[model samples]
Target: MSERLNGIEAFVAAVEAGNFALAAQRLGLTRSAVGKSVARLEARLGTRLFHRTTRSQSLTEDGQAYYERCRRALAELDAADAALEAGRLTPSGRLRITMPEVLGRVLVAPLLLELGAQYPELSFDAAFNDRRVDLVEEGLDLAIRSGPLDDSTALAARPMGHQWMGMFASPAYLAARGRPASLEALLAQASAHRFVGYVRDSGRPPWQFRDAKGQAVAFTPSSQFDFGCNSLEIAAMAAMQGAGIARLPVWLVREALDQGRLVRVFEEPQAFGYAVHAVWPHARAMPLKTRVLIDLLVERLVPALAVR
Candidate 1:
């Protein structure tokens, strides 16, 4: 029975990838190995599955029918695996995840900690960075991402919540410089006031605002005191020191706003903020650990971000 299935994966991979070389790459095997495996499969069935040439290969009539049957067989096997996984009552495994640094530390970490405490069998390996990650390449189980997502068929995303950005300044700075009455006034006074800005490797991003019509507009303020740093925490710290007005995520400075260290300059948040998501590689049967974590985030993180 095992011998009957020996080259089935290689043959299907070649068909789907359009060439043995690409199939080899997908299967993590050498090109020669893939070719040999397909040859063995053909010998076992006493039929040619592909029309091979120096440059390319095409599926034979028999190969096309066999490929369809094999695909269904594989899917059934996957469903069987999923059935057993669903029956398990306890989640037990090491879940490796990556997320943006600031949100991961302040908003996501406590929920993960609570999960760990509830399930002794579950453990975590978490990495926090601001860069986008490839889950399959990095062997990560899941990721927490914010902002716009690129269209992808290779992964799945579940919305966690929205993170709103608000402009803020220290009370001392507000007292000394006076708060601008409107967005127009703020832009008019840009030259006179310092702005604590967040800088990315690509360059500084413009601060976002909503006009009266509720359309989004961007403003790039000039600041001699700009730290040119990527960390949002650093920008918030600078704003707390009376350095300049800063645009930051409301969740990040919740403590400072409550403590009176920072005062919100704008009465309202930006029109559209980053939409947070929990992303993971697509699978027929998701690992129990990954599914539970995603569910927890959906349950808890949304309300946490809603807190002003």
Candidate 2:
């Protein structure tokens, strides 16, 4: 039975490839091996499959009939395999996800493209949300949120990665004001600096960092020359315009840092860090498609979201 299958495979490759030499390449066998396999098949079937020729090889009358049957059989086998795969885990249907606009653009967007390519039947409904929405009420499959999952009660939560907050300023601002040699120098140069504050109606955000001794230090930006809102995207842009220094997420400022548009103010480890959480509604059974996507996101996001 195994020999018959091998012979059939060689016969198929030869017919499709148009020559034994090409068939040998496709089958990962020597040209003589392919020829011998085809000859064995012909002997078993009591009919020659191909007309021997120096210039060209064409299928014989019996060969043409057998080729069609073999092609259909192989196609059916492929379809069977596909059916089993679909039954086991069908990565199809609408996968609605809610995430921050900035995170979506920076990290999730490229990964989503890769996911789409991997699962052809799958489609995505992405909402770049800044405000919290009722996931169950809104009919969302997943939500990627920053900070702690303290609000999580009815949702299954998984932390994507640790997101570090760093003091970032534009190159022009650093150049004009002179880069701070140390964290102390940065704090002491307060009069020479302005801040792009992140306001949440609670108040202006405190510029949080870790001291060299690993102590948490928080200081509110007193000199606010520009806008103060909850948007990291806006605050990052404000810093780039030389408005002031702002505490920005590494992922958000990575492009700017790489291009030297923005520079980290301190070498000390940032004290303020947040986790991006993947949350899904607690239910009887998670959908296979949803599980597949969540697994994929968690696997891809952890390393991609690293601060390096």
In order of appearance, the predictions have TM-scores of: 0.73, 0.64
Task: List, residue by residue over 51-161, the lDDT tens digit for candidate 1.
Answer: 988988998999999999988887787789878987889888899999999899987889889999999999999998889988888899999999976554345577777
Worst 10 residues of 2 by lDDT: 148-157
Model 2 lDDT per residue over 1-308, tens place: 65676678789889999999998666546687778889989999999999988989999999999999998877786677566666765588788998988787778878777888888888999988567888888999988888756432245566688777888899898888888776687778877777786776555657666776778787765755366877788999999889888888887888899998899876665356777878787542467678887788878888777764
Which sections of candidate 2 miss by over 4 Å? 1-88, 181-184, 200-203, 212-215, 223-230, 269-271
- Angstrom error of the Cα, residue 273, model 2: value is 1.3
Model 2 residue pairs with clashes: none
Go through the candidates in order and give each one's C-alpha lDDT.
0.82, 0.78
